[model samples]
Target: MMEIVSSTVEIVIGLLVLIGALFSAFSAFGLLRLPDVYLRAHAATKSTTLGVLCVLSGAFFFFWYFDNYISARLLLGILFVFITAPIAGHLNGRAAYRTDVPLWEQSVQDELEPLLKGKKMKYEEKDMME
Candidate 1:
């Protein structure tokens, strides 16, 4: 019975690790092959977030099940991720947009365009002087 439980847990952990690995690898590939910064940012944010979540969940499972620790780190990690990941991704995308990185032709209604018009150089100069 112990053997069966251990084997099952191992299988589940291995599957999570494999999926995480695949997502991370795809993010790397997209970063290399994607034509533009915005698209690359999209891939990097989505895939890497998912990959990290999978890896974290696997860690949580391993610790909770194998070590029998009552510290629910997984729930904490999930909450942290849920709150921060989208914020970070949004910041990254916003940075890309502010830098005037061209979006794909299919992109609709770039609201940032007017916000940045005639102001990027001033900001750039201030940043450089700092």
Candidate 2:
């Protein structure tokens, strides 16, 4: 019974690892194929983060079960990735926009465009003051 349970656990861990790898590969493909900075960043961050989370989870389970050692570090890594990935992606997209990176031709609506256009540059404001 114990052996059967152990084998099942191992199989589950293997599946998690396999799924994580597939997500990672898909993320890479997205990065290569996506036309613009924003979409590429989105793909890389979202999918890659999920991949890393799954891989870390599998590692956590494997180490805890087989090595008789619970790894706090792996759990912490998963937490860090989950927390930062979206924020980082957002910052990257904002930076790209501020630098005037063009959006893809098929992009339907840019909510930022109008808002950015309405804002005055500091130089323009200074000239207006004078």
Stretch of 10 with least lDDT, candidate 1: 70-79
> Model 2, stretches more than 4 Å misplaced?
120-123
- lDDT score at residue 92, model 2, on the 0-100 scale: 96
Alpha-carbon shift of residue 41 in model 1 (angstroms): 0.9
Query: Model 1, 13: alpha-carbon shift in Å?
Result: 1.2
Q: Write the per-residue lDDT of candidate 1 for residues 1-130, one digit (tens) a residue.
A: 9999999998999899789889989989999998777878778888988887888878878878899885567878877886787788789888877666778887777776777765877788899999
Error of 1 at 112 (Å): 6.9
- RMSD to native, candidate 2: 1.8
User: Best-fitting candidate, measured by TM-score?
Assistant: 2
Could you tell me which residue pairs clash in candidate 1?
A: none
Which candidate achieves the best lDDT against the true structure?
A: 2
Please list all clashing residue pairs in model 2, or write none if there are none: none
lDDT, model 1: 0.83
* Number of colliding residue pairs in model 2: 0
lDDT of each: 0.83, 0.93
